[model samples]
Target: MSATRRQILSGAGASVAGIAFTGALSELFAGSASAASGVRAPGDRPPRGGYGPLVPDPRGLLDLPAGFRYKVLSRQGDPLRSGEGPVPSNHDGMGAFPGHRGRVHLVRNHENKTTGKLGVPTVPGLTYDPAAKGGCTVLELDGRNHVLGERVAVAGTAVNCAGGPTPWNTWLTCEETEDKAGTNGYAKDHGFVFEVDGADPRRTGAVPLTALGRFQHEAVAVDPRSGIVYETEDAFDRPFGLFYRFLPRKPLGGTGSLRAGGALEAMRVPGVPDLSAVRETGTRFEGVEWVPVPDPLAAETPIRFQDFGPKGITHAQKLEGCYWGGRAVYFVSSFARTGDGSAATHFGQVWKYEPHRRRLTLVVVFGPSTDIRLPGESPDNICLAPTGGLMVSEDGGGAQHVFGVSERGEVYPVARGRQNIGTPEEPEWGEFAGVTFSPDRSTMYVNCYTPGTTFAVTGPWHR
Candidate 1:
């Protein structure tokens, strides 16, 4: 039996209600609660039968399942409709929204720094820092996934990495660097979340949302109900990064509401100081609490180093993707290796946090794997599939792929990267980022981090 598009979009199995699996796939995830933690051995391969198997693209760009195909919506050097020089390089995190006249609007981030191959053109009003090269660009696509136009949404931010969409139809583009002013010729201290209005680029003021805290931010997820913004820090130093939540002063007031100011706090799980130490899946942390970051702006010290009492704030290595689904916030730790100073080693881990219940659960954990092609390794930029599971963009070594993980812990490959930007002797495949679906769930949009390409993929999504 073929799965419907709606079923494929919202079919999260047991992790999400109203979806059930049968036969082999069901048995793959049909273990005891403890046994269903989604942990695999180092050499264990991911379960197959996702969309059959990926067929290499004749164009040698992206490989998808037999019936699926992709179209290049935008490229690094492509001309923009707004007459802005060109689409900037290093396309990173992105958000897709319902566009005017049944179209789709995408706000894409360029992970450029002070110096890069091509910087986001610093338009007069859209630019925040003249010396910064990282920002966001807005792209409009028609029903057929044709690019209607592309323009700068926000600019002049440094190291724009991965961010999340807002409940108010905006995109939060984050800076993944803690570089301060006077460093790298920066005019102002970098590292803040900036809101981009995908529907109307003019509404994006290029103003930094300072209250959200200044740190090495990876991504954010806004709770549609409470309007609280959950942020992840991607610092990979000795201190690591903290999971943060911003209590917006104005709840769900739409764009620019975050600027009204709110409390920035770090998450603390009583006895757990570092998330990397927890190697087991399905590990539950009860009564999780948030502690105020005395210095969110990091005027004297970074938020992670700020005093959070005797227990101290919890920290994690490589805190990356974040999204809100099933009334909880889902976040990712891309990978934790002992050589990277982590207490434990793992390919990846997905965590779910229940706000009302103050409970945190490890939903999916990828065990150590030497194989770089392992589907679940280094899962980044995750989104809730309309069909019922989670889609993860791979950022680890080896051939890159966008992976799908069912709610019951069934893993499958959705798409693979076949583009080799490097020479044949040293083939290099860019990491996948910004794996998001359109409002209609008919298209899946993703980014190739290098040579910077944005693709709109559509096919038999329900298979």
Candidate 2:
């Protein structure tokens, strides 16, 4: 979802092409009449008393809110152990542990989006690579970006996308392939989450969370209170896809095994019974509710809440990048179809899910009408900054950047990607895919999936 697209430039519901100047303004400022009738638009930004870039060139260096610095913790091909092997490439998703004395455990998801060459053959014990088999890596890092200890070879997983950190200090590595085992040496069953622990490698209890129905798994977020895990899908078939939640069979106490079966459910905008009915208008949709998990676990979930659909119905669009931020769950769609009938839809949006209040609200939408210089920038993995905002990863190529979006609707780039990430001829690190802060929120750990490198960024990010 890039801002340069003319479709998203039109604003809320109307197309910006060849319209009256005043009409264009209204379209951008106009609130959705069908959903939350009188609610204010989420695109408003407050005047900043003080704000500026903290680093000289935020590209390689980490951009903190304020008073922060970063260090190169580790790079790909770095030696982990005596006989293990060099660090693999395409380090996608990562996690950091605070209690481990600054030791960070990361599950690097290899893209294989390009040519395979994953880095398994390099390791002696590791022997798997259909489209590339380099799953998760547990690396221990200090505050100064020093590698304390590391263990590689997650064993039997490929195309590992983004994963979520569990309440029990373990990383849940998810295989993003829709194909099951047998097709390739990847996960015997695709679309599953594997539990990996840093302290105990010999413990050997890693199991695939089959209960959490197999699909194009993107990311998972677990609720510490009930151990209920929220999930996202990356499917592109038919009426788009859905956002799901997995409730573990037992309570999440002390965090042991995540294999226990539980209830799995998908999200529904309630009143919008037929998703097909929603016209392909790129208006920012809001006021959605959760639906049941469905018996077959393949769409068809019963509606639970209905208020924002039907008459003025609109699709939730591509719901990707979700995380537990503040007291609520925050989710964002990659891009919505432009009402202007263009192949590109640059209006990317973010929403907040409040379980206690049982209400869903649109927090922000970016496009030609908004503050983001580039609309339609697909925001990948997201996390809430300690200063209380969202740290988003931009996977889009041209405007590739890591954004620190303030709660007041201010969007600023914290880092940028060098044109070409990695290649023998032109190797350049680019973009932070996953960003997480220490419990204290004083330090931030960022990773460049393009170059497959991770850095420890320490600074005063909180204004």
Candidate 3:
């Protein structure tokens, strides 16, 4: 069925009945439950198959529930305005911004770092480090979430993975890998967060947010009230991964402010000392403190192995997605146990951070990763839902999916992915990324990795 404004407007009042987002933080607070609505808060156990059973898609592209449907917004090899080799592959993270004149802009990341011809070429002054690949592209969409035009926003970076949208209407794309300067043909030191305006791609700065610290950066979420940036590291090296907070010298500076420098600290439990966060689900920890990292940019040593390491700084395994939630920041630790102070389990873990209270809680966990029948596992990217919940993109071993969690933590398949079998050795079982909503909440945008496809999904979400 064709998605229309009427279909969404007719159900908006009814779906938002049980949930309400108010205050200046409405945009950042994706889906936080209200007690009056009879919805449970974070750290609560979710019911199995909460949304509904997945109804297979006849077209074998994606599976959705009865009323929900999706439309392919962009596909791999789609020619861009710059003709940049049909949009480089490995579409990782993305941000959807409100465009001028009712249009929507999507700043997408091409997770490219190869020496091949797939990366976006340099655009004179707009390029960061022309010697390196892996940058972002901007897509303009109409009111109905249809693609209008797309062009390279910023090129000349490395491993342009997931990032969060700033309150000032800019996109912060983070490089997942930390390839130093002059090494592996890299012209400059990689592993830094660069800001790009979705509206004007040419204005993207050529410098990185050095104050934000350099490690295997994955994703970030900024608290608008305080402008405190909460970051997650995907470093699988010796010291493992750690949750971080960037205390900028000035708040509300908006974009291009982090380059001035700031205090980067690691999240830690005050009295308990060393914490690996390798426990069961529903685990809660209070008195969380921020320990200063001796060095933000560690060339020889990993950032997590600095003075904070011996001080018993807390750490997790493969910290991937980070999102600003109700009075807190929720992050995900994608699978990794046994050797990193965690127990042997294939499932992933979700954690919540309360900035005001300085507390961290293990809200949701996907256990027994060996079980292929579970609702969700190894959640990679996450975003707020209009239903006052969360939508997570699964990057696990089994069939990929975009899982939806309710206010009470109910897990169900909101969308199922189909593997495009092109080569006998490889079936392109796409992993979903960039699960964000439109400015008006009429549509939810997501992406798949394998074939690099972006989709706009809409339906009776609350129902």
Candidate 4:
């Protein structure tokens, strides 16, 4: 899952660029009462202090604010409660759902390719392709953040990257590869989203939702009101990737609804061909339209490469994290550099799309910075804070951190990665992923990508 590392260029200090707006847009910038209930909207300036300075951890695994502490919930190679072999590696995107007896269910993705320390157990009925090695695991935890049980939810999928949770309490685990059945001993074509039922493993069939389009999927956001599924493609190639929306035939229908099929379309901004070309913050693109994907399965060519008439679909570099907040669907462009064939370069960008108005707004743009500790570059997996804000997991160079951006736009570190599973002579800090809060928001759960580990963090969230 590692891409070619690009040179870090020095530039003006980091800045969270934004412009003022009134009415609904203003409410969107602030915490919208109608926005996905507890989720906070993105877009604001960065003020200094947040919870407070992060205190170094005594265990040397994580660094958090003064009042915060974390517990290791699960680690790679650990025995599973189901006795289905050991845990898999490369823990990535995850979703938290309400479980029975006041328990919280977490469905986590294992971004494993053809190889890993231990593949997700291909338990007979739950396996999609025996040759594949990437899937999801469901972890049950009580209110106190104590693990109740953990088991395999889905198995046999490959390159399971980041996916979003549905309104019906299931998780959409996306495959982040375009490998075909004949390649690398794969028995089936990969790169499709699979629905995993965290509450009941039996309900998850491990079937791929092919209508959602086959590509290098990064993440998805579903509109609670419309049931429209918005998807992001993370292809790092020359043509880059296109933002997509899957209009399910069975919108809002629970579980197997996505299997009924839907139209997969790419988003277009008329004159804007590449989103990376947009430099200024608050750059609004009105009258946005959706173009039907010529081939959702991409049997012969990728969706982004397929011709979309003279207008063509809009593309962006490193389209990563995505989630529904209030009335808008927020997505991230991790970063763009000149060496990557992007029209322009920037450290990071967060975009807000309003379906009702057919408007796309650039809410937050991170200016270039040389500091590796800064939380402005390569922002990945994100979730709405229960206390009204957004928590972004950093996947950039140097030390990684889980950052909190309040509705007022105050950027602060929520936690930092200090774990070095590698040798002491060649230390490595794995990028943080799956930054999500429990249903009650009492505990925050995140994952370390390398030497995979899950953490349950508790602290004075209100403070």
RMSD of each: 8.2, 8.9, 7.8, 4.9
Q: Best by lDDT, which number?
A: 4
Task: State every prediction's TM-score relative to the real structure.
Answer: 0.88, 0.73, 0.84, 0.90
| Candidate lDDT values, in order | 0.79, 0.54, 0.72, 0.80
lDDT (Cα, tens digit) per residue for candidate 4, span 134-210: 99999999888888999999999998999998989999999998889988889999989999999897787888999
| Tens digits of per-residue lDDT for model 1, 255-290 | 888989999999999999889888665689999999
The regions of model 3 sitting more than 4 angstroms off are 1-55, 271-282, 339-346, 369-373, 422-428
Model 4 alpha-carbon miss at residue 121, Å: 1.5
lDDT-best of 1 and 4: 4
Predicted model with the maximum TM-score: 4
Task: Report the poorest 10 consecutive residues by lDDT, candidate 3.
Answer: 14-23
lDDT of 2 at 310: 44
Sort the predicted structures by TM-score, highest score first: 4, 1, 3, 2
